[model samples]
Target: DQQVKQNSPSLSVQEGRISILNCDYTNSMFDYFLWYKKYPAEGPTFLISISSIKDKNEDGRFTVFLNKSAKHLSLHIVPSQPGDSAVYFCAAPYNNNDMRFGAGTRLTVKP
Candidate 1:
């Protein structure tokens, strides 16, 4: 069974609009939540992250919110741009040395 899940396979938004991606997790031991953005051929690069102790974290146009009680988290992009279009993954460290990732959500930002 997958510990992390992304129910939405894909999402689309007009440029300069807002984009929201959702993620859920079953494990409570995960204290660190992270978001990664991946282009076609390149590996995923870190976007933003939040500690389980905090409810929200933001960096520039990207923000991550964690709801521990609901076992849910979401990534929000404000004024989404075309360059932001990519497959986004939610992840948390597992086994203290590795990570567990959600299925990923492909975001399309159209001009």
Candidate 2:
């Protein structure tokens, strides 16, 4: 069974607008949430992460909000720029070696 899911295959937003990406996980064992961004052929780069102990975490223009009760999490990018367009993946690790990744959501920031 898929532990993590990104229901929307893609999302589009105009420049300078807010872009929200949603993720859902079935595993309650996951205690940490991670977000990664990948450009075409490049490896996914870590964006931000949040611990289950915290409801929200933010870094600059990016923020991750976790709703433990709902088994849901979301990444919000404020004033999204064209350079921010990429495939964003939500991940959770149950242990050091076992990690679950949501099917990425392709974000298109139109200028």
Local distance difference test scores for all models = 0.95, 0.97
Q: Mark the regions of model 2 whose C-alpha exceeds 4 Å error after superposition.
A: none
- Model 1 misplacement above 4 A: none
List, in order, the clash count of every candidate structure: 0, 0
Give me the overall lDDT of model 2.
0.97
Tens-digit per-residue lDDT, 1-111, candidate 2: 889999999999999999999999998989999999999989999999999999999999999999999999999999899999999999999789988999999999999
Any idea what lDDT model 1 has? 0.95
Please write out the lDDT profile of model 1 over residues 1-111, one tens digit for every residue.
899999999999999999999999999999999999999999999999999889999999998999999999999999899999999999999877899999999999999
TM-score per model over all chains: 0.97, 0.98
Which candidate's lDDT is highest? 2
